[model samples]
Target: MKSFAEIRRIAIARKGEHELAARMPGPPERPLRDLSDDRVLAEFSRRIFQTGLSWKVVDGKWPGFEAAFHRFDIARNAMMSDDDLDAHLRDTGIVRHGAKILSVRDNAIFLGDLARAHGSAARFLADWPATDAMGLYDLLGRCGARLGGMTGPYALRVLGYDGPLLSKSVVAALNMAGALDGAATSKAARVRAQEAFNTWHEESGVPYAVISRTLALAVPD
Candidate 1:
């Protein structure tokens, strides 16, 4: 495995190379403020939730998803009729997997309930205490939320959550922080990754959004 320094060197070397430009998908250049709308936030979460699926597929089918899910209106989706769900499952543009679609709807309902209980999703998430890796993994397991892995936490980090999120971007950020070697593999890698993030935030004079964009673009599909 390459050391964190080695990975950084590779990343720096590839930064402006024509070949890399051709191969690397650039992150969306739009400012994070543009993505702060509730609808946009829902879409962003949906995209991340659809990780295993191709972005091309997701983008192309987004219209179908939007129509099917009432444009992802949390309140409306929470009360979706069975006919609505059936129609969604029948739609060819979006992923028609029954369970996956159901999960989306279920998550919406759950999110609504959470909001009602906690006041707001943002507040709920914010109020949730910061946690370490094992703690996060356990929480996900308890929630019966599928598709989240160690990488899920990192994804949250890149998404700008104040608390822990274990996703690849976090891993890369960790390497940049020198908390973990780029190639380092261990349970403690996550903790080290968090430390690295803190350091980068302090020294790089760059915002998390920029760092996230850089990291997202660096990832190979």
Candidate 2:
């Protein structure tokens, strides 16, 4: 097995030769003024979560989700009446996967309670320690939230989050750090790649975030 430094050096050498594209426009730098509005945040999260899914599948149906779930009002979602939810299942516009939809509702309610207990959802999320790729995958798997995998997490990283969101840029940083094997094939290999890259950045005094962004710039569209 290669030492972490060796992996980083290999990754840097294999950094996709194509010129990087412009950064995709990400969320705003500052939180919205009414950041506490759960409904809006839920909407944003929903939209983001739906990215890889067909928009046609989620667009017209979103209103149904909005209406059926009390506009995703955290308080209301927590207090959702079973009868109301049953009625919502009958709606034609929404995705009919009961479990998945319910998961969203449950997550909303859970997040709401967490916020109330922790003072703010942002703060609560921020308190969670940053993790490498494998750690993030495990966390998401344990949470039972749908649609999150390596690619999904990478997208989340690009989308930005209250907590560290790993991105391709981070992957690049990992590569720079000697964390990745240029020949990596599986998800586990990719994760090892990230660890190597991060270790390199930490020891080299290179700002990981800057390295990530710079590496992101090297990725082709």
Candidate 3:
């Protein structure tokens, strides 16, 4: 793998320093403010609902979603009766997809369970090491409903966790760097990819989020 310095230089040339800086994820000191178990579940729900759908549409209807789901309060949403979910089927304000709606309730249950097991969902996420992003993703896949694929990491990003997300651009950059054979989807591949990022973090003394953004910016869109 190319040194992070070399990769960052290439990214600066390709995207310009200003643009690259803008695209970079925030430092750890700046938390994704107002994060709570409920908000985390809300962001997870947002990502799940946006899958294979128009993000624009989903974003525009977010208020309705907050209202419909009681702002994704973990306890309230976990207790969402079958009738409540059924009511959303006809609610035009938000997306009417049945499976996604069900996933929200499922995810709420997941978060509630986590709270019971580990104080709160926020504490669990806050305590996880950003360097082990793949490990955290694995945990999310197991404990959180419908948090497979990129959804888990993307949700983490949205919730202000400073970690690497295997976004398309980042994955392409990793492939170019010979970090892995292809997309790092399988468990073994993901583990290898996470180790690469950890190495970069060690080399640069930079946060994983910044290293991830730098690598992504190094690649052409």
Candidate 4:
């Protein structure tokens, strides 16, 4: 794998320092350990709903979603009644896709289990090693509802877990760097991708999230 410095240099050259600095994923606004479980579920729901959809439209209706979901209180959602679901389908406040709506309850139940084991889902997420991003990805896919593909990773970053996102451009840059081949849609490819990012992070002490964005920026539009 190429050093993060080389990749970042390429990104800076392509995007310029000003834009790069402006756009890079920075440290979490609040410490991850302190993040509320409700907010964590909210992010998961947001990413799930946003997949293959217009993010702008989701953002616009987020208030309604928040209200409908009671700000994503974990216990409340984990116990969603069929009647509540039927009501959500009839409500115009949020996207009413049955499966996606069901994911909210499922993920909440998942989080509730995490809290039972870890005391809080926040601690479990905040304490996970970012170097093991692939492990995290695998765990979410195995356990969390509808968190396969890019959904879990996107939600993780938004939840303040600093890790690489296998976005299209980032995947292209990984292939270019010989760290990955074809799409990183399989488990082995994801492991290879994580190994590459771990090497870059160890070599340069840069956060995986920034490295991911840098790699994407390295690729021209």
lDDT for residue 40 in candidate 1, whole number 0-100: 33
How many residue pairs clash in all the candidates, one count each? 7, 8, 0, 0
Worst 10 residues of 1 by lDDT: 31-40
Ranking by lDDT: 4, 3, 1, 2
TM-score of 1: 0.60
lDDT of each: 0.53, 0.52, 0.86, 0.91
Best by TM-score: 4
Of the candidates numbered 2 and 3, which has the greater lDDT value? Answer: 3
Task: Give the clashing residue pairs of candidate 4, or none.
Answer: none
Candidate No. with top lDDT: 4
* Model 4 misplacement above 4 A: none
Model 3: lDDT to the true structure:
0.86
lDDT of residue 146 for candidate 3: 85
- Among all windows of 10 consecutive residues in model 3, the one with the lowest summed lDDT is 26-35
TM-score rank order:
4, 3, 1, 2
**What is the per-residue lDDT of model 4 for residues 1-221, given as tens digits with 9 covering 90 to 100?**
66778888888898899999999887888987898899999999999999889999899999999999999999999999999999999989999899999999999999899999999998898899988978988889999989988899899988789989999999999998889879998889989999999898888787889889889999976
Instruction: Report the C-alpha displacement of residue 28, candidate 2, in angstroms.
Output: 2.2
- Write model 3 residue lDDT over 9-99, tens digit each, in one string: 9999999999998887764433654367888888899999999998999999999999999988888888878799889998999999998
Clashes by residue pair, model 2: 7-178, 8-178, 8-179, 174-197, 179-193, 179-196, 179-197, 180-193
For model 1, residues 182-216, the per-residue Cα lDDT tens digits are 64345566556545544445555444434434443
TM, every model: 0.60, 0.60, 0.93, 0.96
